[model samples]
Target: MNNDHDSSLPEGLDLRALSAFVDGELPPVERAAIEAQLAQQPQAAARVAAWRAQKTALQVLCGASLRNERQAHNESSGGVGQRDVDEPAFIVVRRPTPWWQRVGLAACWLAAGAGLALALGPLAPRLTGGAWNGLGGQPPSFAERADIAYAVYTPERRHPVEVAASEEEHLINWLSKRLNRPLSVPSLQEYGYSLVGGRLLPGEAGPAAQFMYENTSGARLTLYITGISRDETAFRLFRDGNRRTFYWINDRMGYALSGPIAEGKLRAIAIEVCSALGGKPESWQ
Candidate 1:
């Protein structure tokens, strides 16, 4: 093998070697080499851990199917007992390779790739410096967290906010102090939404704020705010089912406006809110 390190895997190790090591099929010398590499490389160790986790998950998911297949095979081969004397009952008997596995290492690589995708999710992109938008298996973006918060709190008939809109000043001052930034509530009255209240939320970096608003028809929107290290300002949209969020970064502050509303309407409101909060107009998208 070339053994040159790549973005995804460690030097001197590939999926085949890793899989065989996981299966306890590697010889003593090769296994020792892999063990040494894993001991020295945290990334490689993480990959091995993920593959092991994936194998366990697959065994659980496919247990019944595998049992049925095994039963059929045993019936055709003089009805072998359910368990071997030395080997566990769960172990599949050795036989000719299946069609999928017959394609050689390519199929193994593909299967491992799928397992890796499942194990890493959104974090895989950050790990490999690639682009992936899959959800879960990692902490979500600020906007996605906003979307989850919206879904959680919006349906409540009462107690949707920690502080009611009647005490808007106290809510703003409290959140501002907690967030270490002067926070202000944007007036959405022109868009037929009135402030319902605001609440404190747990953010990835620190405390965050969520300001809720409601229209006469009971439609609700939330504005999520937090301090960010990124100084660049750019507008981006995130959607989950019927909910949508328009998030932007400006002046080291992150803002995400989320609701079950049309995209254009939400974008317009996000722009207006950004402008009100001192974000430059040219940064709106």
Candidate 2:
């Protein structure tokens, strides 16, 4: 075969071994032998040297591309800018907005909003009863929050309560300390419901507690208690779909009993819980 079209590697050195030797990936013995071959064979030495030069050039090209991309990204994000080094850094320019123009813009926006609302008619969203109402710094109502908390944790199986009911005393003590009040667990064993455990949670106004209870049929009820801004003696019953929530505020503390039970049955349980908390459920309106 012609030398240029040999199509075969040098003796004792395959293409893979030569490539590995050029990449410094060979064992010490193999590397020494490859080095000796390169020293003795001009063709093998030239091939290895060409590979090293190509690797260096590739690294330089890739580094330049990455730097260029980064510079472009910084410029687009307003992070990097080209300016004369001797130029003054700070310059002030005034552009005053006329009151009449501002009023005209406001009128245009108002008219567009009104037209949109009229076009949507009955489909328009309610500004008042929304999840986020722009009230004067008022938090969500107790019933809404208790309903959400109940929905979130009632389906839990293994890790329902942060502190299990077996450690009832510790759970109560820990929550009480976190809430800055002497907390008590109302016994529901009379209604076939016993404490499963309780966990400390963040309430709209302050720290809160969710005391979970389960009956013989695996039915769960959560008694959500938190500090309130004012004392409320009257009870209010709120129903959201299948969930019945009986809530009230007493002695600056808000109490809500949430469960999937009927309104009447949950109310009865709420009465017992309210009485335990030094409140009269009969006075609920």
lDDT (Cα atoms) of all candidates against the true structure: 0.84, 0.80
> Candidate 1 residues 1-285, lDDT tens each?
555445598667787888899988999999999999999989989989998888877776647446657778998999874753443446455788777767877878899988987777747778866544334433247877888999999999878999999999999999999999998999999999999999999986999999999999999999999887666665777888999998878888888999988999998999999999999857453
Residue 273, model 2: lDDT of 93
Q: What is the lDDT of residue 193 in candidate 1?
A: 99
Q: TM-score of each candidate? A: 0.54, 0.52
Worst 10 residues of 1 by lDDT: 131-140
RMSD of each: 24.2, 16.3
Candidate 2: residue 281 Cα off by (Å)? 2.4
Indicate the residue-level lDDT of 141 in model 2. Answer: 80
For candidate 1, the per-residue lDDT at 34 reads: 94
lDDT of 2 at 161: 90
- Predicted structure with the largest lDDT when compared to the true one: 1
Q: What does candidate 2's lDDT look like per residue over 126-202, in tens digits?
A: 55344322222232386678888899998999988999989998998999999899999999989899999998888
